[model samples]
Target: MNEKKSVTRLDSTYMDQYDAHVERQGRKKKRLLRRLALFALLTLIVTSSLAIYHVQQRMVYAEKKEEYEQLQEEMGSLKESEENLREEIELLNEEEYVLEIARSNYFFSKEGEIIFKLPNEEPSY
Candidate 1:
């Protein structure tokens, strides 16, 4: 028992204290590395989320822009059609225009008037 106790005391040397100090330093380094890795991971997650959000907004903006262009085209067509209708209405209010349409379409004639609708010799198609 005395020999074993002497041997154990010999093992507890200055080297053991130095080894303990080295182990504590290694633990602190590992902890710091773990914290850095965790920070980098969180930063990556936040950056990825922002990128996804920006892509979604761009998609929405592109869709809205296409819709706006289509509406503008439709609006232009509608305005052109309205103008054509207004011109037709104006022409219909004229007596000469009414007479011409009646003569051409219905072959109408006045008491002394004669309407002749000659067929075209050329094919329409």
Candidate 2:
């Protein structure tokens, strides 16, 4: 077996400067990569939050639209009911309508008036 002689490397000023320059370049590259990754993460979070907000707003709008339509239908029915009640009030304001209702339902009689009641069944001949 031939024994190999270990040649010692001599450290020079130029070699030291080159090593420092290489180390600085490596650190700069690592910093640039970290900044890029952080920027990408922030952009993803903002876009996802915006998308969720948009969906929620759309859902709220749909629910409000449905509620509005239901309210509009209720308003229409209430108006019809109000008109019917107003007509009834006008009829009841006359003395004749109250007299007729009392005479038919409560057996009320005017002077020399006779009352007769008949069954409400249909007769077959």
Candidate 3:
């Protein structure tokens, strides 16, 4: 009877140790799951922020592209005007074209030509 009682006590101690080990493993598993959830939440926030930043950058780029196109069109118009002015300058270098310009712009006349005077219109103000 004494030896049987000793064996029973030893079995109970072993069972208690096994139960403690299983409880410790359960706690560790819970901690791991919590850490994984936190990591997933942080990753989601970072990805969303980066996506918003990229979208804002694209909007800014689109506005700048539109401005660049408008500026290019304005430059093209100015270049055409410059080309027209250059041709006019070349034409004005000729004596006949210069004389015509002077006559039209300055109302110049030959020495023997008669000048006509017109009455000015009254101001409304």
Local lDDT at 8 for model 3 = 41
lDDT (tens digit, per residue) of candidate 2 on 1-125: 89999998669998899999999999999999999999999999999999999999999999999999999999999999999999999999999999999999999999999999987989977
What's the lDDT of the predicted structure labeled candidate 1? 0.93
Tens digits of per-residue lDDT, candidate 3, 21-102, equal: 9999999999999999999999999999999999999999999999999999999999999999999989978999998878
Per-prediction TM-score to the true structure, in the order listed: 0.67, 0.78, 0.75
List residue ranges in candidate 2 displaced over 4 A. 1-15
TM-score of 3: 0.75
Pairs with steric clashes in candidate 3:
none
**Candidate 1 least-lDDT 10 residues:** 1-10
**What does the lDDT read for residue 3 in candidate 3?**
62
Relative to the true structure, candidate 3 has a C-alpha RMSD (angstroms) of 7.2
Q: How do all the candidates rank in terms of TM-score, highest first?
A: 2, 3, 1
lDDT of 2: 0.97
Per-candidate alpha-carbon RMSD to the true structure:
6.6, 4.4, 7.2
Q: Which candidate would rank higher by TM-score, 1 or 2?
A: 2
